[model samples]
Target: MLPVVNNLTLKNYSHLANSDEVSFDVVIPSLPGFGFSSPTPKNWTIDDTARVFNTLMQEVLGYDTYAVHGSDWGAFIGWSLYNSYPKSVRATHMALFPELPLQPEQLEAENITLSKEDAFSEQLWVDNSVGGSAYAVQQRTKPNTIGLALYDNPVGQLAWIAEKYISWSDPRRGTGPSVLNDHEILRVVSLYYLTQSFISAAYIYNQNPSSFAIPLSKAKTDAPFLFSNFKYDTFFIPEQIIRPLTNLVYYKSWDFGGHFCGLDNPPALVQGLREIKKYWHY
Candidate 1:
């Protein structure tokens, strides 16, 4: 779910603003059925959540327009919000671009040689697809099975989530152990166990299995689009491939950090957001 919880609160934005006169009204909602929002309704997909979020901004918060940013499932929901309400969502920034890998036919059609960075990124994707996606496959296809197995078993839940926290982080953060300490891992695992949300959280994969599929017609948005790809993230979408999927306002690549950039490199994440803010017209 959410990144290191402390990193997302409004206080973090104060540091992000620095000397700028920028002020933010941050609204971080728990995804339906995760954390405090339990009992995720049947058929609640990313699109459904996106609609609800839009309503929250427009109606509840009384903001006519707002910018959106996300990573992981939040990235999917952010795109859905932009796509569904382009006028309301003024700009969009994401740390992860969720497009699926290009098909062989598509790659052949381009016939462009990959840069060294692109090549390495591609190899990483291939490796993860082959070896590291078993958990994802299970979540997508049989969430209930694993959910039931882990629901009451705190140790099992801890092991399952902690593995990702270890493996998905930048290896440089550790010499012999993971950057995430046992306490941090236990905090998240405890939240899941206490809330009884571990089961429903996995259902997100089942609800949006085709989330990575890029729209055939380009899925262009009027909102200014930006993304930052940190080196150790699970996948990378090259600039050439990403351009058609977004409005393509800004793009940056970081040599450090990983999937959980908010935790692994909070200042860098904040800096990227600040950069995106420069292009925010609304």
Candidate 2:
């Protein structure tokens, strides 16, 4: 999901532009309690947001069906949308699928072998779980603590969000200078500071603590699924594991880009979505 400070239209993925055969009317909405949207009631989760968005497309916008694409939190909500309203959401595309890797014991029991890429991805996951994910833990358990701390301090907020933007992006773009300029970063930070919505945005982690939990059933959605694995992303799930989880129609791995594909490599991100259009059924 785009952060609270980031609106849906902020990133320009030019590859989503209309073509003779395909055209897209993108509807970019802020998550509840984020950006200009009102705060969610206590205990709201991704599922709740999905329901609201479904209504927006079906009832409000007067569409009988729709398709969805998401990264990060948006991916979680996309899963919920596909699961909860199978008939309404026709297809799904995602940059990040929040599924844990097979445990070492499970891999051993299955006699699974890892490729060079898979091994690297596995190591990154292990490293992040050990320390790189401290921010997630804090947001999950004590959102208000950090929220209150960074709420009014723009510098503090910048440092908090900017770090992720830098670390989670392609090394080429994230290092030395960022793909996003200081002005852009400031704009995002200012949105949270002026609106004081960072608190509720951070609360999403607390509300959905089970987000990281591995699915009990690997087969989660029957809807067609498309996934793009960017090299520098936090972790990359092997196709062997992903194949069982959904009707994975297309999967591609890039040598560049990272967690923030929309910013780091907008064309590639948009191209991935365009590829999904081939499998999308009305």
Candidate lDDT scores, in order, read: 0.77, 0.77
Kindly report which residue pairs in candidate 2 clash with one another. Answer: 1-73, 1-74
lDDT of 2 by residue, 81-169 (tens): 87778888888888888666566566668677777766766666667667688899999999999999988888898899988877766
Give the residue spans of candidate 2 off by over 4 A: 1-21, 103-110, 174-178, 181-183, 214-221
TM-score of each: 0.87, 0.87
- Residue 212 CA displacement from its true place in model 1, Å: 2.8
In TM-score terms, which candidate is top? 1
Candidate 1 — which pairs collide?
A: none
What's model 1's lDDT at 58? Answer: 96
